[model samples]
Target chain A: MSQTHVVPTRVYYTIFAILMFCTYLTVQVAFLDLGALNTVAALAIAVFKAVLVVLFFMHVKYSTRLTWVVVIGGAFWLGILLALTMTDYLSRAWGTFG
Target chain B: MLPDAVEHHHPALAHQFDSLAQQREAAALGMWVFLVTEVLFFGGLFATYAVYRWWYPDAFAAASHELDILLGGTNTAVLITSSLTMALAVHSAQLGRRRLLLLFLIATMALGCVFLGIKGVEYYHKFVEHHVPGPGFEFEAAYARQAQIFFSLYFIMTGLHAVHMIIGIGIMLAMFWMSWRGRITADYYNPIEVSGLYWHFVDIVWIFLFPLLYLIGRHA
Candidate 1:
């Protein structure tokens, strides 16, 4: 039987701390007037927190290459959905077709 | 040679599989595929949300201020902590620490319940404020129609997330029972690990949902 990797308890605690800190930061940043940067700042913190969770909590960091492929593929598909849909929506205001 | 052959026949090993590692890998792969589908499922709603938010940025922002960030932020912390406990539970199962495994499982469930409880409170506030998206819906007159669209997306997205949390709690409860009866051991803990993946995925959804729903339009 192959041995499974056991993550240390301290690692979980550290990630938890960082996640909480980021949560606080996102909430605080939201109240500030950063113009267009507000949305960008919030999403950036969220993406960072999600990476921490995926790598540590989900153990994708320790997962096999196949698993990594699946994870990236999922995100890539979502990107495709967003990109194609947004292109049509954003271009609607450019001008109506003759 | 006989003993070696017998060692290969672990009860958890199916007849089709040559080895335990193969079985475990197959199961993990299957779960990942399912999770990929789940991502797309939620992805559609996110796409719809983004489209509307882009079209009606001002109204969306004005409507978002109605939500309680304090409660939303608190729930984010709660859910993230639950993810931590769930991760630790999987770790304990790997190490064959049955007691710690059970402890963390229950901890994770308790935190999940806290999150739902807080969500319920938020929903109640929404109802009291006439934020439900039908005829009784209330908002500033100028932004009323567009704001209703915002709240509609809010309810659908967050409500779907809450349903997933309830299902995850049910799964954890079953895992708790299995662990208590010694059904889960270090050698056969795939159930725990896979379920941990589900729970963590749910948490990841909320990690994105919180900022998208609560933080983005607050300043408006």
Candidate 2:
């Protein structure tokens, strides 16, 4: 008799509100004069929002660690693919033509 | 031995499983595996975007800057809200709150429609601006060739995502009807849970998409 633990309804609703606000904040980051830091700031905000969604929206935070593994594994693999590929592509002309 | 008397058991279930709960877990894991493949699919497209953005930095930035931040940001808000509604819908199903589940599902679909509508407007703007890639598609001279590449990735990535949105909407319609017909109960609500996962995955995709397509080259 395994019982799943569900989050309290109010908590879930509160997380949703916070996620909406975070998404709005990502947009607001654009209007700031961060200069070269704008991209960094925007991406950092996006990551924060993504964390909130994964933790609360998905309920992975309360689930078994195996569930978290599946998710983090998927994301980490994608990171690897993007990183290794860009290493070649972004550095193609680093010391050469221009 | 039918326990056809059992409230939750269906004849379709295989005997190996102890309960519908096990079956549902297997089904969910299968769906997640399918989603892994989906990751690889979009992975290819993102790789292409990265290569092109780096190769033609100026053009990519200019194209991104042309994007309406209001539209992009609004859509981001719309999508995150939809994900919230989706999560709520699943929560309702878990709690056996049928009416609440229906309400959340409808809310999710409405928000989804808003996203596509805004996207349609953006596409229309692109058409009017001749930013679409192909013949008769023109751009400022400094970024003529690469800008087209940028739009090419733009259309392809977001276009595929839009197609998925349409499919998700269709699925939601079917789920809504089934729920209305009393086919789904708290005990047999795996369909809703599965749909929620798909919806969340789409939201996650857009989470990445906002940065790649709308933010990456903007400051350039």
Candidate 3:
């Protein structure tokens, strides 16, 4: 039987601490008037926290290449969904809705 | 004795799989595929939300202010911590530590319940404030209609996410029961690991949800 790579407990704790810190940062940043950057900053922090969870907690970091393909393919498809839909919406004339 | 009777078979291993590693890999791959579908399921709503929020920034921002950051932020921490416990649970199972595995699984479920409890409180506040986005819904007169759209997306997105959380807790319960029965051991802990993936995926959805629903419009 092949041995599975065991993630150490301290690694979990460290990831938890970083997630908590990012949560605090996102909330605090939200209250500041950074104009357009507000949305950017919030999303950036969220994406960072999500990557950590996906990599460490979800074990995708140690997953096989086939697993990586599925994970990345899923993300790529989501990007298509968001990007294509937004391009059409943003390009339309405002009067078209009314 | 029959020749076949001389071979010992792992109860968890199916006849088709050559080894435990192959079985575990197949299980993990299948679970990830399911999660990929879930991503798109939630992604459509996210796309809808982005378009509307862009079109009606002021109304969306004003509507978002009604969400209490304190509660939302706390829930983010709660869910993330639950993810940690879940990872630890999977780790314990890998080590064949049944008692620790059970402890961490229970902790993960309790935290999940806490998150849903907080969500219920927030939803209650929404109802009390007439933010339910239907006929009786009310907001500032100018932004009322667009704000209702915000609340509508809010309810649908977070509501879907909450449903996922409830399902995640159910999955954990099964894991707990199986572990209690000693069905899960270091040699075959695919169930615990796969379930952790589901739990962590739910947590990741909230990781994005908190900021999009609660934080993005805060400064406006």
C-alpha local distance difference test of each model: 0.91, 0.80, 0.92
The model with the greater lDDT, 2 or 3, is: 3
**Per-model TM values vs. the true structure:** 0.96, 0.89, 0.96
Ranking by TM-score: 1, 3, 2
- After superposing candidate 3 on the true structure, give the runs of residues whose Cα lies further than 4 Å from its correct spot: A94-98, B1-8
lDDT of 3 by residue, B1-220 (tens): 7666336567877988888899999999999999999999999999999999989999888988999989998899899889988999999999999999999999999999999999999999999999999999989999999999999999999999999999999999999999999999999999999999999999999999998888766665
* Candidate 2 error regions (>4 Å): A33-36, A95-98, B1-14, B216-220
Q: Kindly report which residue pairs in candidate 2 clash with one another.
A: none
Using lDDT, rank the candidates from best to worst. Answer: 3, 1, 2
Instruction: Give the per-residue Cα lDDT of candidate 2 at B127.
Output: 96
The true-versus-predicted C-alpha distance at residue B40 of model 2, in Å, is 1.9
In model 1, how large is the Cα lDDT of residue B210? 92
Worst 10 residues of 1 chain B by lDDT: B18-27
For model 2, report DockQ.
0.46
- In the range B170-207, model 1's lDDT, one tens digit per residue, is 99999999999998888888899899999999998999
Score candidate 1 by TM-score against the native: 0.96
